[model samples]
Structure formats: C-alpha cells, structure tokens
Target: MIALEKQLKDELKRFEAKEESIETIFIGGGTPSTVDPILYQKIFKLLKPYIKTNAEITTEANPNSATKAWLQGMYDLGVNRVSFGVQSFDQDKLKALNRAHSPKQAKIAVLTAKEIGFKNLSLDLIYNYQGDTKALLKSDIEQAFELPINHISAYELTIESGTKFASTPKVRQEDDELAFFVAKEITKHGFKHYEISNFGSYESEHNKGYWKLKDYIGVGAGAVGFLKDTRYYPSTDIDAYIKNPLKIKEESLTTDELLTERLFLGLRSNIGVDKNILNKAMKKRADFLVEKEKLFKDNNLYKNTNYFISDELVLYILG
Candidate 1:
C-alpha cells in the first residue's frame, strides 16, 4: 500500500496535473473491497487537491467482501459511487462462474451501500454462459432492477487465455441473439444503452472519458496511462513494482493505430466518430453504411444504429 502511494505520487508529479483537474476517479481491475479502507486514506489524501469537488469517485467491490463497515468507511472518505461484481443472481449460474458470493450476499452488499448513502451504485451481470437462456438472463435482469442501482454492465461470456474456461472453451455459449435480448431487457427498464456492454439511468463518466479518447493517468502494477499518443505502463509483477516503482514502459501509438482505436471505441458507444477524422475511403464506406441505414450521421459525426454489429461495421469502414 505504501509503495502504491509512492508510485501514484510519482506518477502525478510526472504528469504535473493541475488542482481540481481530475473529474473522475475509478479504483478497479481487482477485488478492492477486500482491502481495508484505511489503506486507501493516504492515496485519497494525496489526490484530494487534484480531484474535482464534484468528482464521480468510484470503486469496484466484490459482493462477498463489501461489508457494511467497508462501505461506510469508503463513503466517509468521499467515495460516492460503487460498482459491485454481482455477475448473476442465480445460485447455479454463480456456481458455474465460480463466483464467491451468493445471491443473498450480493443483495445485502448493494443494499448496504445504498443505506450508507451512496446515490450511485452499479453491478455487473454475465450472460451467454453454456447454460444461459433468455429465461435465465431475464430473471437476472429482473433481480438486478430490484436493487437500488442506476447502472448495470451485462457482458457475454468469453474465454480468455490463462483462465480455466480457456481449456474447456465450450463453457462459453456462442449466441449472438442473447446480447440483444439482454440489452433490450435492460433498456426496457429505462436505463439507456450508453455503451455495448453498459446500461445506466446515470451514465458512467469514467466509461465516457475512455470512449472519447481523453487522456488519463493510470497507476499500480499492470496499470496503463495515456498522454496524447503515448501510453505508460509500470511493472506488472506486484513485488517488482513495490521494489522499484519507477520501472516503467512506454508505447507511442501510430496514426493508423489511433484511427483504428477511434473507430472501434466510437462505434461501440454513443460517442460517435468525428467525420473529419475519417479519410476519403473510410468516409465513402461510412456514407455507404449510412445509405444502408446501418449508421446515422448527426451533422458532423457518424453513429452506429446497432452496437451489436459495431465490430463488423468498423472493419468494413477500415477496409
């Protein structure tokens, strides 16, 4: 924890961030609720000057570990938002996904946060597992809406390398329709489908910042930071990072790479691509899609009509 504080302090120094410049801060990428909130105090104290007064500060928590005391401590520290990893409300599905918490525990964790005065709460739901069905996903969505949360992120099950499912890849179902089903069910309840995987009555500022290609400072092991066209990375190994927090890597993105990123990110969300950023060939392809009703041009920006076909459309434009 001390090492992380030092590293964050160093990273901020390098960036020369101005006071009240950070509009949002998200503490995620791992199970953060397991850590004592006291450990977070120094980091918050150090970042207080740079964080805006109305900053949408968020921390990702596991339902099993985010106890009432933990939520209260973080709330006292000015963390006004919480994103819980609920995954699913079905016991069998939770077991299948190897989640540590039960449905009851997930409910308690979220309700506890709400009772503690958190106005902004979000939870994640995973769909398209081997046994996932419309009935099952519908129930999951229904249970989620029962909670006092404004946001939900429904993700399709994908086998990533190094995970147990990578060996038995069949655990992930290959169902395209379920994505639409889940999206429709979520938006039916009034939350906007602001991104491919996320829906919310109150949209996430952190998510929007990334899609709009805004620069952000990332800290801790394996965290990535962006400044203009360059990306910064510290050591991935926790021990190595703590030992020498200064060791870092840098990558400068090419113009073509940046363009590809913009196309994918912009199409995946309501943050449509700027027309001026497209070359003549890409513009021609985009216009063709607009003619086909696959995309709609909002004056100077071109937005996707269906996020599900976003990848294919971006690839078409790129070609």
Candidate 2:
C-alpha cells in the first residue's frame, strides 16, 4: 500500500503537468479485491481531480475475496465497475485450472456486486482448455447469462512461459474449430463479440483506448505504459519499484512498427483501422477481404467480420 501511494503520487504529478484527464481506471492483473477497500480511499481522493465526470473506475477481483463489504466500500469510493476473475463455474473445470473459488462462490460474488450498486459488471471465462467439452462450455455460458454481468471475456487457455501448464503442456487445447464454437455460443446470448476475447454489451473504455492507441500511464511493478510512439516499462522487480518508481526503460517505435500495431490491434477488435493508414497493396487486400465477405467496411474504416480468424486475416492483409 505504501509503495502504491508513492507511485500514484508520482504519476499524479505527470498528469498535472500534461493536463491529462483520465476517462477510465482499471485495477487489474493482480487480485485488487484482496486489498482492503480503505487502502484505495486515499488514492481515489488524490485522483478525484483528474478523473472525468463519468469515468469508469474498475477493479479486477477474485470471486472468493470480493466480499459484499469490499464491493460496497469500493463502490462508495467511486468504483462503478467490477471485473471478477471467475474462470469457470463447473467444479471439474475449476479444479483443472486450480481456481481457489468454487462455483457457488462465483454466483454469490456477482450478485453481491450487483446488489451493492455496481452498474457495470464483467466476468472472465476460460474456454478451449484440454478436456473442455462442448457440453461443459455450453454450461458455463448458460450459467454466465444467469448472472447480472454485462460483459464476458471468454479467453482460450494458453500455456505461457514458466507456468505450471508449460510443464504439463497437455492442459492447452487451442484450435480454430473450438474457438469459433465458443465465440458463436457467447454471441448467441446477445453479448456482442466486440473483441477477439471479449464479449459485452458494456465495452471497456480503458481497453478500447488501447486499440485506438490512446496514451495511458501504467503504474506498479511490471507495468507498461504507452504514449504516442514511445512505450515505457518500469522495473519488473517489486523491491526495485518500491525503492524508485521512476526508474523506467523506454522503447521508441518506428513508423512501420506503429502501423503494424495499428493494423493488428484494430482488426482484433471492433475498433476498425482507417483506410488511409494502409498502402496500395494493403488496400487491395482489404478490398479483397471485403469482396469475399470476410471484412466489413464502415465508412472509411475496414473491420474483420469474425474475430476468431483475426490473426490469419491480419497476416493475409499485411502479407
């Protein structure tokens, strides 16, 4: 908490100097609900000035730790949105993923947050893991609809470096067939598949900003921030960050690199990229995809018809 305060104070100074007005605040990647709500009170007070009038203040929480008191306390402190990390509602799937919370606990947490006046609620659901059957996926989707959440992030399980799953390697089941099925099922429930992994009636403005290449200040250890053509990375070491939060490594992107990012990120989400950004060759490919009914044109922007094949589409367009 003390370290976080120091970091926030430093970031606040930058905001003031740049006259930056923040539209969204997402407290995620770590279990924020585990921290006492009182810890955020001082931080919110300090940030109240720069926050926009209708800013979405979100906190990512675990189903087990986000109690009613915690939800109410944060809501009172200006947290209008809560994204719970409820990976699965099935007991076997929960155990396979090693989630601490049970199925019942996930239900209780969402209901609790909604009852406490959280207007915008979201939950994460992992699909396409090994042993994840169509029946199991359907059940998870149905259970999610029963909850009061307005958004759902249905992610495919990937075995990243140094994780326990990496050792087993058998836990991951990623394929185009399964991905399309899972995505179609979620959209059938009326949640727009806004992003490749995210589906929601209430899209995350913070996430949308990233796709649009908006600048944001990322705090804490191992956090990355983007500002125009440059990206900043603070020390990943927690102790080093607490000692000096200002020590950051910077990377400058070239015009080509930025263009590549704009294309890839834009196609992966509903945020379509401008036609003016593409060259003669890329524009031809975009037109081809449009003719094939794989891409849609909205005014001057080109968007992917299905997000499941976004990577392949990006490669073909940029090839």
lDDT of 2 by residue, 48-75 (tens): 7788888888999999999999998899
Give the number of the best model, judged by TM-score: 1
TM-score of 2: 0.96
Per residue, candidate 1 scores C-alpha lDDT tens digits across 1-319 of 8888888888888888999999999998789899999999999999999999889999999999999999999999999999999999999999989999999999999999999999799999999899899999999999999999999999888888988889999898899999999999999999999899999999999989999888888988888888889899989899999998888899999999999999999999999999999999999999999999999999899999689999999999999
TM-scores for all predictions: 0.98, 0.96
Question: Where's the lowest-lDDT run of ten residues in candidate 1?
Answer: 2-11
Q: Which regions of candidate 2 deviate over 4 angstroms? A: 13-20
Candidate 1 clash figure, as a count = 0
Residue 243 displacement (Å), model 1: 1.2
User: Where in model 1 is the C-alpha error above 4 Å?
Assistant: none
Report, for every candidate in turn, its global Cα lDDT versus the true structure.
0.93, 0.88
